[model samples]
Target chain A: MRGRGKKYWLEEIIFIGPAVLFFSLIVLIPFFIGMTYSFTTWNGVNDEITFVGFSNFLSIFKDEGFIDSFCFTAKFTVVSVTLSNIIGLSLAILLTRRLKISKPLRTVFFIPNVISGLLLGFIWQFIFTKGFGAIGSLTQIPFFKLSWLGTESTAFWALIIVTLWQTSGYLMVIYISGIINVPTELKEAAQIDGANHRQYFRHIMIPMIMPSVTVCLFLAISWAFKMFDLNYSLTKGGPYNSTKSIALDIYIEAFQINRYGTGAAKAFIFFVVVALITFIQVRITKRKEVEA
Target chain B: MIRILKNHRRIALEIVALLLALICLSPFYFVIVNSFKSYKEILIDPASLPVKWILDNYINTWKELRFPAVFANSLIITICSNLGIIIISSMAAYRLLRVKTKLNKAIFGIFVMAMVIPFQSIMIPLVRVMSSLNLNTSNIGLIICYFGFGVSFPVFLYHGFMKSIPISIEEAAIVDGCTSLGVFFKMVMPLLKPMTATVIILNTLWIWNDFLLPSLMLHSRELYTIPLAMNGFFAKYTKQWDLALAGLVLSIAPMIILFLSLQKNIINGIVSGSVKG
Candidate 1:
C-alpha cells in the first residue's frame, strides 16, 4: 500500500506539476505581489519603495483623468453592451430562419471578428478618416461628413460603432446556439395554438434562451470593460482622452507614465469592479434561465 | 394569395439579411479596393472601382512592414504556444480529474477563479516578475507566458470533456502493462480530438490576435508579432493610407484565409466552446 501510494503520487506530479508550477509563477505570484505594490510608492524601475498606505488609492479617486476614464468606460460599457446584444440577437434570429443565404451571411458577419482588434481599429481608422471623407464628398451626405474620430462625442459613438461591428457577430453566434437549442416541438405547439410570430417568440424563445443572454452579456461586458487594443489604434483614446478605457488608462499609467504604484492601485480597483459587475450580471441572468 | 404573401415576406427577409451582409462586408470591400488605388485616387473616391490596379503599395508595405519576418514570428509563437497549452493543460486536467483529492480540487478551483482576473490587474507586477525571472524579452518568454495564461480555459474545457470519458478504458489499458503516461498519450489523448480542435481554434484566434501581452513582453523590434508590427507601421505612416491599407490587408490575409477555408470547423468549434462555457 505504501509503495502504491508513492507511485500514485509520482504519477500525479509527473502529470499535473507543470500546470500548477506555471499558473503559480505567472498568475498567482504576480497577482499577490501586485496587491502589495498597490500600497507602496515604488516606481517600476526603482529600489526606493516607500510603503504609503492607501494614498495611491486615495489619489486615484481625486484624479480627474481617472474619474473621467471610469465614467467613460461605464458609459461605453452600457451603450456597447446593449447595442451589441440587441444587434446580435436580431442577427441570430434572422439567420436562424429558413433562409437561403444564412450560412454565407453568418460568415460575412463573423469575418470581422476573426481580424485582430488592433488591426480592426486600424482598418476603421482609415475608413473614418479617408474612406468616410471620400464617401461623404461623393455622396454629399452630411451624416458621413462629420469627423467621426475627430471630436469627442462622435469619437465616443465611433468607438461604440466599431465595437458593435466587431463583436455583434460573435454574440450572434452565441445566440444562434441558444435559439437553436429551443425545441422545435415547442415552436410547433405554439403554431398550433394560433399564436402570432411575436407572441411565440416573446413567450417561448426568449425564456428558453435566457442562458445564452447570460453568456452574451457576460462576454460583451467583459470585452467592453477591458477594451484596450481598439482604444489604442482606433483613436489612441484621443480627441483628448474622451474615449479612454480604464484598461488603457492603467496601461498608460504603468508603462507610459511609469506610475506603477498608482497604476497597480487602479488595476486592482478595475479588477474588483469588473469582477463585481460580471458576477452580478451573471447571477441575475442565470436566475432567469429556464432548464427547458 | 396568402401563401404568395408569406413567400413574399420570406423573400423580403432574405433580401434584408443579404443587404446587411453586404453592409458588413463593405469595410473589407473598401479596404481591398482602396488598397489597389494610389493615394490621390483613393482620396477622390474610395467607393469607386480602381482605374488602375497597382502593386506598388503592396510591394512597399510588404518591404516596410517586413511582412515575412513578422509573419513567421507570429506563426511560430502561435503554434508553439498552442502546442504547449495542449500538452500541459490536458495532462494536468487528466490528472486533476482522475486524482480527485482535496488539494487537486482546490488547485483546479483556483485555476478557474483566475479566469476572471483580467490581465491588466496583474500586468504591473507581472512585468517585475518576468524581469526578475529573465522572461521579459524573448519569443520563448512570451510563449511561456501564454502557456501560463492559456492553461486555465483549456484545462477547464478539458476537465468538462474528460468527465464524460470512461475511466474503464484507461483502467483496461493499465491492466495491459501501459504506464500512466503511456495510457494518457496513447489512449486518452486520441479520444480528446474534438475538444482539442475546439481548444486549438479558440486559443489560436486569441494568441494570434493578442497584442498587449506580446507588446509588453517583447520590446525588441525583431520579436514583434503581426499586430505589434502593424501597430508600429500605422503609427509611422499615419497618413500614408495607400501603403497602410495594403499592410492591413497583408496582416489579416493569412488568418482570413485560414478562417475561410476552415470556417465550418471554426464556427462549430466556437459554438461548442461557448455552449460548454
Candidate 2:
C-alpha cells in the first residue's frame, strides 16, 4: 500500500502537474485578475490604478450604446440560434436520408465551416457590396443599392444572414450525428404503424433529437454572444455603430479606445447575462430530458 | 408508377441543393475573381472576371503583405503551439487517468468548468499576466499562452477517451519490467492515435486561424500570424480592394488546402468530439 501510494503520487506529478500549472497561470488566475480590474481604472498601458468599486458597472448600465449593444447581441443570439438550428436540423435530416450522394452533399454544405469566420465575413461583404450592387443595377432594385452594413435594420439582418450561412452547415453536421444515432427500430415501428411523414417527424424525430437540439442551441447562443470576427470584418460595428455586438464593443473598448477597465466591466456583465441564460436553459432542458 | 414521381422529387431536391451550393460558392467567386481585377474595374464591374487578367495584384500583394516572413511566422506559431498542447495535454491526461485520487477528480472538475467560461472574460487578464511575466511579443511567450489556453479542453477530451481504455494494457507493460514512462511511450501512447488526431486537427485549425490572441500578444510585426497579417493588410490598404482580396485569399490558402486534403478526418473528429461531449 505504501509503494502504491508512492506510485500514485509520482504519476500525478508527471501527468497532471504541467497542465494544472499552465491552466492556473493562463486561465484561472488571469480570469480572477481581470475581474478585479473591472472594479479599478486600468488603461492597460499605465501602472497607476485605483479600485473604484461598482462605478464601472454603474456607468456601463447607463451608457446608451452599451445598452444598444446588449440588446443587439440578445436579438442576434435569438435570431441566429433559432434559424441555425431549424435550418441545420432540416439539412441534417435530408443528409441522413438513405441517398447515394449524401456524403458529397454534406461535404459541400460543410465547406464554409472550415474557413475562418473573418474570411467568411469578408467574402460575404464582397458579395453584398459588389455582387449585389451589380444585381441591383441590372434589376434596378432600390433596396439592393442601399448599403448592407451601413443601415441599422439591414446591418442587423446582414449579420444574422452571414452567421447563419457560415454556421448552419456546422450545426447540421452535429444534428446529422444526432439523427443517425436515434434508435432506428423506434423510427421504423412508427413508420409501420400507419403514421405519415409529418406525424413521424413530430412525434418521434423531434423528441429523439432533443438532446442535439439542446446542445446546438447552447453552442449557437454562446457563439452569437461572443461573435467578433464576423462583426469586425464585415461591419467593424458599422457606419454609426449599428452592428456592434457586446463582444465587438468590449474589443473596441480595450483595443481601440484603450478603456481596459470599461471593456472588462462589459465582459463581466456579458458573462453574467450569458451564464444566467445558459444555466436556465440547462435546467429546463435537463428536466425535460429526465421526464422524456 | 410511383417511381417516376420519386425521380421528379429527387430532381427537385437536387435543384434546390444546387441553388444553395451556388449561394455558398458565390463568395469565393467574389474573392477570387475580384483579386484579378483592377481596383477601378472591380468597382465598375465587381461581378465579372478580370478583363485585363492582371497578375499585378498578386505580385503587389505578395510584396506589400511581407508574404514570406508572415507566412513563416504563422507556420512557426501554429506548429509550436500545437506541439506544446499535444505534449502537455496528453501527459496530463495520462496521469489523470492513472491516478484516480481526490485531487484528480477536482482537477477534472476544473477542466470541465473551463470549457464553458467565455474567453472574453479572461482575455484582458491573460494579457496582463503576459505583460507582467515580460513574455509579451516573444514567439515563446505566445506559444506558452496558446498552450496554457488550449490545454484544458484537449486534456478533457483525452481524459474522457482514455478512461475507456482498459488499465490492463498498462499493467501488462509494467509487469514486463517497463517503467511508467516507457510503458506510456511504448504502449499507451500509440493506442491514443485517434484521439491524438482529433486533438491535433482541432487545435491546429484553431491556432492557425486565431486572430485575437496573436493580435494581442504580438505587437512585433515579425511575429504576426496569418490572421493578424491579413488584418494588417486591411488596415494599411483600406481602399485597395484588389491587393486586399489577393492577400485574404493567400492568407486562407493553407487552411483551405488542409481542409480539402484531410476533410474526412476533420469531419470525423468534429462529429465525434461534439457528439461525445
Candidate 3:
C-alpha cells in the first residue's frame, strides 16, 4: 500500500509538473514581483531600488498625460463598444436571415478579423492617406478629403472605425449562435400575437440573446480598454498624443521613458480597473441571461 | 398579395446586406489593387485599376522585410507555443480533474484568478524576470513566455472538457496493465480532439497575430515576427506605400488562407470558445 501510494504520487507529478512550473515562473511569480516593483523607484536599469510607497500612484493623479490617456481610453471604450455591438448585432440579424449571399457575406465580414491588427492598421493608413485622397479628388466628396490621421478628432474616430471593422464580425458569430438557440416556437407565438418586427426584436429576440450580449459586451470592453496594437500601428497616439490608450501609455512610460516604477504603478491601477469593470459587467449581464 | 409583399421585403433586405458586405470588402480592394500600382500611378488615381501592374513592390518588400525568415519565425513560435500549451494544459487539467485534492483545487483556483489579471500588470516585471532568467530576445524565451501566459485559458477549456469524459475508460486501461502516461497519451488525448481543436484554433490566431509581447521580447531585426517586421518596415518606409501595401498583403495572406481553408472549424471554434467563456 505504501509503495502504491508513492507510485501514484510519482504519476501525478509526471502529469502535472510542467504546467505548474511554467505557470508559476511566467505568470504567478511575475505578477507578485510586478506588484512589489510598483512600490519602488526602480528605473529598470540600475540595481539600486528605493521603496517609494504609494507616491508613484499618487503622482499619476497629477500627471496630465496619464489623465488625458485615461479619459481618452474611457471615451474610446464607450464609443467603440456601443458601435461594435450595435453593428455586430445588426450584422448578426442580417446574416441569420435566409439570404442567398449569407455565407459569402459572412466570409467577407470575417476576413478582416483574421488579419493582424498591425496589418489592418497599416492597410487603413493607406486608405486614409492615399486612397481617400484619390477618391476625394475624383468624386469630390468632402468626407473623404479630411486629414484622417493628421487631426486629433478624426484620428480618434479612425481608431474606432478600424476596431469596429475588425471586431464586429467576431461578435456577429456569437450573436448568430445566440439567435439560433432562440426557440422557433417562441418566435411563432410572438408572430401569432401580432408583434411587429421592432416589437419582436425588442421584447423577444433581445431577451433571448441576452447571453450573447453579455459575452459581446465583456469582450468589447476588454478589447477596447486594453487596446494597444491597433493604436500602435494606426495612430501611434498621434496628433499630440490625443489618441493614446492606457496600454500604449504604459508601454511608452516604461520602455520609451524608462519610468519603470511609475509604469508599474500605472499598470497596477490599470489592471485593477480592468478587473473590476469586467467583473461587474459580467455579473450584471449574467443575471439577465435566460436558460434558453 | 401580402406574401408577395413579404418576399419583396426579404429580397430588398438581402440586397441591402449584400451592399453592406461590399462596403466591408472595399478596403481589401483598395489594398490589393493599389499594391500593384506604381507610386505615381497610385497617387494619380487610387480608385482606378492599375495602369501598369508592377512586380517591383512585392519583390523589393519581400527582400527588405526578409519575408521568408520572419514568416518562419512566426510559424515556429506559434506552432511550438500551441503544442506546448496543448500538451501541458491537457495533462495538468486531466490530473486536476481526477485528483480532487486540496493542492490541486488550490492550483486550479490560482489559474482561474490569474485569468482576470491583465498582461499589462505583469509585463513590467515580466521583462525583469525574463532578463534575469536570460529569456529575453530569444525565440525559445518568447515561446516559454507564451506557454505561461497561454496556459490559463486552455487549462480552463480542457478542465471543463475533461469533466464530461468518463473515468471508466482510463480505469479500463489501467486494468489492462497500461501505465498512467500511456493511458493519457493513447486513450485520453484521442478523446480530447474536439476541445484540442478549439484550443489550437483560438491560440494559433492569438499567438500568430500577437505583436505586443513579441515586440517587447524581441529587439533584434533577425528575431522579428511578421507583425513586428511589418511595423519596422512601415516605420522605415512610411512614404513608400508601394512597398508597404505589398508587405501588408503578404503578411495577411497566410492567415487569410488558413482561415478560408478552416472557415467552418474556425468559426465553430470561436463561437464555442466565446460562449463557454
Q: Pick the candidate with the highest lDDT.
A: 1
> Could you tally the backbone clashes for each prediction?
0, 0, 0
Give the number of the best model, judged by TM-score. 1
| Model 3 Cα lDDT, one tens digit per residue, B1-277 | 9999989999999989988998898899999998998888877788989988889999999899999999999999999999999999999999988988888898899888888888888899998999998889689999999999999888899899889899998999899999888999999999999999999999999999999999889988898999999998999998788888899999999999999999999999999888887
On the 0 to 100 scale, the lDDT of residue B90 in model 3 is 96
- What lDDT does candidate 2 reach at residue A250? 88
TM-score of 1: 0.98
Structure candidate 2, residue pairs in collision: none
Worst 10 residues of 2 chain B by lDDT: B15-24
Residue-level lDDT tens digits of model 1 in A1-292: 3445788878878898999888888898988899999999888887999999999999999999999999999999999999999999999999999899998888889998899999999999888987788778888999789999989999999999899999999999989988998998998999999899999889999999998898898889999999999999898889899989999999999999998999999999998998899789888998898876
Report, in order, each candidate's fnat.
0.83, 0.57, 0.86
- Which ten-residue region of model 3 chain A has the weakest summed lDDT? A1-10
Give candidate 1's root-mean-square deviation (CA, Å). Answer: 1.3
Clashing pairs in 1: none
Candidate 3 TM-score for chain A: 0.96
lDDT of 1 by residue, B1-277 (tens): 9999989999999999999998888889899999999999987788888999999999999899999999999999999999999999999999999988888899899998889999999999998898898988789989988988999999999999999999999999899999999999999999999999999999999999999999999999999999999989988998888999999999999999999999989989998888787
| Residue-by-residue lDDT tens digits, candidate 2, A1-292 | 3455777677777777888888899888988888898998889898889899999999999999999888888889989999998899988887776556778778777877777777777777777888789878988999779788768889888999888888898899889887887787887798789889899888887888778877788778888988988898988888688889888898889878988898898888888887888888877776654222
* Over 4 Å off, model 2: A1-7, A141-143, A290-292
Ranking by DockQ: 1, 3, 2
Stretches > 4 Å off in candidate 3: A1-4
